[model samples]
Target: MFTKILVALDRSPMGKQVFEQALALAKATGASLMLLHVLSAEEEGSPYAPLLTNFDYYPGVGSQSFEHYQKQWDNFKNEGIQLLQSLSAQANTAGVNAEFTQQLGSPGRLICQLATTWGADLIIMGRRGRSGLKELFLGSVSNYVLHHAPCSVHVISVPSQVTQAEEAPQETASVN
Candidate 1:
């Protein structure tokens, strides 16, 4: 029933899965799909902020919070743009009308905002993301989107890597 769909993705397998799923849905509905990725200031860097708060997590956590995350944030933005491009190509090959947007900000907040700005009818995303336990404590982007999405939101739970690993043994046994 959806005509406009938005999918958020990063450089993770789960993100890939989410995009694939969205593309399939778009194809079935003859809908348009948007691939959006947002880079957090903390994940990228706030070089333009009036005042810089040092970031010292990964390498420079001891600095202030801004210095350390700037480079990382930049990398995240650039990498995410590349990924969105690749996803757009795949969607095109699938004969699905797809466009992409790479923005900067908090992932959850930005995702929800795009849904409104793009007038998306539906949002499809992974329930658990790459953030791991930190996401659990901070609440996941999916969680936030689920609660705040304008129209409708579908939070699909992707099977974890650990489960895929464990399933290998079962897969081979089942094959024989």
Candidate 2:
């Protein structure tokens, strides 16, 4: 019954699964898909300013550094653009009407805003399955979206084995 489905892509290992699920849902429901990827300022550094504050540099060196950061920012955004384009192509190839947006902001806030702006009836995304103190400390975009999204949210949880493999510490055998 969903006419517009928004998929929030985080580019995590779980991304492929999330896209596949969203694509399938859209196909089954004959819904158009909107793929959204947010490039967080904290993750990519601020785009409008150099991160190195309180520093003095030789003539032209400051400009060079700022240019370097700007190049990095462009590359970061380009990567997101390429990813969204690729995902959109996949959906289009599967006969689903799909469009994408790559924005810079808080992921949760951006996703909710886009969902409202796009009139999405359903949102599908992958959850890292963080809980307890780890989730509290790291914060959870999925959790925030679930609470604040304008539409229904479907969170595909990461598998336990995947979580364990990523988070579990290596063990060493004791010498007798």
Clash number for each model: 14, 0
Candidate 2 residue-wise lDDT, 43-122, digit = tens? 42336454456335445557668768779879888888898999999999999999999887788899999999999999
Worst 10 residues of 2 by lDDT: 42-51
RMSD in Å for all candidates:
6.7, 3.3
Candidate 2 stretches with Cα past 4 Å from truth are 41-61, 172-176
TM-score to true structure, per model: 0.71, 0.85
Q: Cα miss at 92, model 2 (Å)?
A: 0.6
State the lDDT at 138 in candidate 2: 68
Write one digit per residue (lDDT tens) for candidate 1, span 52-156: 443333463455456555676576667778889888998999998899998867888999899999999999887654355666566677777888889888777
Least accurate 10 contiguous residues by lDDT in model 1: 42-51
lDDT (0 to 1) per candidate:
0.76, 0.86
